[model samples]
Target: MKISLKTIIAGGALAAIAALAIAAPAADNWENHCAKCHGADGKGQTKAGKKLNVKDYTDAKVQSEFSDADIVKATTSGISDKAGKEKMKAYKDELSEAEIKEMAGYIRKFKK
Candidate 1:
């Protein structure tokens, strides 16, 4: 097979685009899952959200206080414990650090 230079460049570009496309949805899902409890507006006011006393995601005071590393830790370890209440589970095992970082970015969008 004679692999042309143009074909190689095109393939590399295609691969990069495909990776981004796949990653975008995973990040979106992470955002949505966080939103369900945190509220679409990140206000923690959904009918099914109050049980957890969900964090006020849009609070500028709260958001500004945390560093990106802190936010990623929150997602991996979670802000709540799963003791008395069935809070959201730790995602450290389910998601990679990079993926969680993306979720952290998504979380920032909710901040006021």
Candidate 2:
């Protein structure tokens, strides 16, 4: 059996496309989904962030408060206030499990 060069190149291209479809870069995802509230610097200083009283990711004390699992759960299930009003929308529908995990790691990088 012989595989043509064209077939090999096509296969590689398809694999790359599939990988991209599976997981986007964490920074891009953050900017698209979380930055409006979390801020690009992760300080939670945006207008929305201020209104919602979002935590400052740059705070070392804040970073120490949550585990990676906590991050994943909050992201997967979303957050609500004590009154049951939704604060953050769930991303489980938009992101894969792997992507969610990556987001947790990305959030950790915000610690200052």
Candidate 3:
């Protein structure tokens, strides 16, 4: 069957919109649900993050201390547990493994 120009254009447009729609919501979710505590820039600005002196992902020394695995675990379980405390809320139930990774990668940006 031949693909019509109209069909091709519509399909391409749909794909483009779909891609943006999907990617945007995830980033927004990460920002709204997690950013406040983690800092919009991902430096751990949550009230607890501040009181407990949360790890600064932007710090070269701090970022270097943990591997990618460590970041994902930290996001999923909570920063306090990884660091040995109760300063953070465990997100194991709240967020998926992929989301946790996204948050980690978001924070990793600060390392530079």
Candidate 4:
């Protein structure tokens, strides 16, 4: 059985497309999880954000204060108020290790 040149070209194109799809990273987890408090723009201006007094991730100074490790820890373990009560819910149970690590990088993009 002989394959036509067009068939070979179409197959190659489909393979390339499939490869690109697999290589591309999924949408940031922050949108689904953090955005409610952080805001889609990362300004931390939502009502919950205001109530919790969530820090604006878009602020460069705030971004500089936390290392990537800090971000990862907070994400996995959750944050607390001055009284040591948990304010944020821990994602350690919900997300994978790799996803939590990726979230650290995702949050950094909020910095101006």
Give the number of the best model, judged by TM-score. Answer: 2
Q: For residues 1-112, could you state the per-residue lDDT of candidate 3 as single tens digits? A: 7999999999999999997665445468667676666676768877856876667777899988989888777667765545576766777776767677777676677786
lDDT (Cα, 0-100) at 111 in candidate 3: 82
Using lDDT as the measure, the top candidate is 2
TM-score-wise, the better of 1 and 4 is 4
Give the Cα-based TM-score of candidate 2 against the true structure.
0.85
How would the candidate models be sorted by TM-score, starting from the highest? 2, 4, 1, 3
Q: Clash pairs of candidate 3?
A: 37-46
RMSD to truth, every model? 3.9, 2.3, 4.7, 4.7
Q: What's the CA RMSD of model 1 in angstroms?
A: 3.9
After superposition, the stretches of candidate 1 with alpha carbons farther than 4 Å from their true spots are 1-27, 80-86
List, in order, the clash count of every candidate structure: 0, 0, 1, 0
Pairs of colliding residues, candidate 1: none
Model 2 C-alpha lDDT per residue in residues 5-110, reported as the tens digit of each score: 9999999999999998778899989998899999999998999999999999989999999999999999999999899999999999999898899999999999
> Compared with the true structure, what per-residue lDDT tens digits does model 4 show for residues 20-71?
5443332446777788888888888999989888899889999999999998
- TM-score to native of every candidate shown: 0.63, 0.85, 0.62, 0.73
Pull out the clashing pairs in model 2: none
Poorly placed runs, candidate 2 (over 4 Å): 1-11
Residues 1-112 of candidate 1 have per-residue lDDT tens digits of 8999999999999999998765555446655566677776778887767977877878889788889898788778866554654367677776767788887777788776
| Candidate 4 runs further than 4 Å off | 1-28
| Per-candidate local distance difference test | 0.74, 0.93, 0.73, 0.83
